[model samples]
Target: MRRILVTGARGQLGSQLLRCAEDKGLQAAGVGSAELDITDRDAVDRWVEPDAVVINCAAYTAVDGAESDEAAARAVNEIGARNLAAACSRAGAGLIQVSTDYVFAGDRAGDAAVPYEADDPTGPRSVYGRTKLAGERAVHAELPSAQIVRTAWVYTGTAGGSSGAGADFVATMLRLERERDTVRVVDDQMGAPTYSVDLAAGLLELACTGGRGVTTLHATNAGSATRFDLARAVFAEVGADPERVQPCSSAEFAKPAPRPAYSVLSPRSWEAAGLTPLRPWWEALADALARLG
Candidate 1:
């Protein structure tokens, strides 16, 4: 069995990947930024092994913060990815780079808001998005055969979710359901609410099977929803009244970095690559809540 080496091991996806790999009895190891700074080319070279398939989950994912810290974001998202790709190239190892749906402009509406295909033209509008797109380009440039998997709205049902915020959207909704009589959520933005555990499983399968003909693919829970829909679902799942959640517009809570209005990634490319399609977003959310309790 090929060894699995996960970067950003302490992260939601990385940690879940590690657990899944161990459960499957795969030879796997993980390294966080503290253990292996991917931005340091020499350190990455020293850390990467020839027989391992490296899953790069390390990233500067502070979307709002990236507006001011573009250099830091680029260091991790672009240069750091380049370093990993170069090391993998030299070591004759496989690389799977994690990406985001923020790479697209995502301004389409109504009938035009179809899911984004892997080969669609990119139009990133935020520093985080731009830097991540650069990382994708860098990875492809350094290692043409490396696989890039893009996902969106990823969350762990755990206490502290992946967003680096105090609590993730789901956790926050749970809190709000308890503290307030009503809650407001943005309904204009749409994307799949991907469960980190599900994504990790798919990635592990990809790591084990090696690349198909395609280099880039999209992975997320099957269905798409707006934040309002998701928050209401969370409330309903926890036996709270879904009607307590109200729909609002993005203008109500503006952030430094712009969020994609439509981020639903198409699974056509992923399924065409012979990978199993992820379950529906609602199903995944139910399972996530069950696991949380």
Candidate 2:
């Protein structure tokens, strides 16, 4: 059995990856930041094994915080990724660098909302986006064979989720439904609401193949929805009135980091690569809510 090594094992995706690996009876080891800091090239070198497939889920994912902490974000998003790629290159190991959809500027062409292709031109608008893009480039530069999987709007809908600060979007909605009479969610932004469990399964399947297919691909639950749509869906799932979730524009809820207005990734590349297509976002949301109950 090929050894599976997961960095950022405490995170939602990494934890799900570990669970999926165990369910499939794959040989897997997980390491959180305390166990192995990816930014330290020497430490990363000592951690990676030549016969293992390293799934790098470690990242500085504080979007708004990145606006003021570029150096910190860059250290993990770019330098850390470079370290892992270099280590993998030296060890002759396989790597799967997890990335975000922020690489795209999120602007649709006129009124048309086209899903972003894997090879689409990138134009990151915020510090977080730019740093993640840098990480992607670094990994490609160091290990051309490494797979870069870009996903969007990922959530587990579980209490005390990976955010560490508080509940994730879905989980938050679930809470607000019980605590508040109504909620307002931004409707302008659009992207796939991917469940972490589903994405982990897809990634594990890719790992089993040893990253032989496409080098870059987008893996998200099929179909797209705005934040408002997702919020309403969550409300409905829990027997709450979906109408209680009202729609608003992004301007109402300003943030430090600029979110992509339309960052839905196309499934063309993923499907073409012979990978199993993820279920639709609505379907995934239903399953996620069920798990929470």
Candidate 3:
């Protein structure tokens, strides 16, 4: 039985991975920032053991916040990644580093929207994106055998039934539906919504199906949607009037960091590795909403 250690155990994806790992009877242990700080090289070195597989879910995911605090973001997303990669290499263990689709500049013409591939050229526009890209480069430099999985629009439905800033879009929409007469969402930004539970399963599959080599793969629920679409779906699911959910431009909801006009990540790499792709976004959304109920 291979031992597994998950960092960022309290995060959306990390928490789901820990839960599924235990439910499926896999040999796994999880630690949050409190127990193990990847930014601390000596601590990571002390925590890692030989023959273990480290699933690194720890990351600084504040997109807008990173605009003002690039240094802090880099500490966790880049330097921290370097520490983890170096430690994993020394321990002679396998590593799976979770990454984000923000690595892409996502400024393509709306009509030219395309799913990003694992080996595609990257040009991150935001500090958060740049730092995460640095993390990927760091992992590759130190531990070329590490698996880097990039995902986007991730929501665990833990944050008041939505996903975003620890609260997901679903949760936010559900809350808004009850509080307001109408919900305004951005329709221009396009991407796939990934349920943490599904992503956790995919990571496990990647770990177990070991023909290991350093690989970059994209994983997310199939299909694409805009925030407007997602919000409308949420309204429909909750028996509210979908018409109350209206579409707006990104400028209407401008933030500190720029979001990719398109964040759809290609699933080709995941499928090429002989792993199963997650179900359609709408289908997964239905299941997730059911669970939240």
Q: What C-alpha lDDT do the candidate models reach, one value each? A: 0.93, 0.92, 0.88
**TM-score, predicted candidate 1 vs. hidden true structure:** 0.98
Q: What is the lDDT of residue 214 in candidate 3?
A: 30
Q: Each candidate's root-mean-square deviation in Å?
A: 1.3, 1.2, 1.8
**Candidate 1 — what's its lDDT?**
0.93
lDDT of 2: 0.92
lDDT (tens digit, per residue) of candidate 1 on 154-254 = 88876676535346677888889989999999999999999988999899989988747579999999999999999999999999999999999999999
The weakest ten consecutive residues by lDDT in model 1 span: 158-167
Off by over 4 Å in 2: 109-111, 162-165
> How well does candidate 3 match the true structure in TM-score terms?
0.96
Q: Which ten residues in a row have the lowest lDDT in candidate 2?
A: 158-167
Number of residue pairs clashing in candidate 3, backbone atoms closer than 3 angstroms, sequence gap of 3 or more or interchain:
9
lDDT of 2 by residue, 1-293 (tens): 67999999998889889998999999999999999999999999999998789999999988999999999999999999999999999999999999999999998856678999999999999999999999999999999999999999999987767536346799889888989998999999999999999999999988887544699999999999999999999998889999999999999999999999999999988887789999999999999888777
Among the numbered candidates, top lDDT falls to: 1
lDDT of 3: 0.88
**In candidate 3, what residue range of length 10 has the lowest lDDT sum?**
157-166
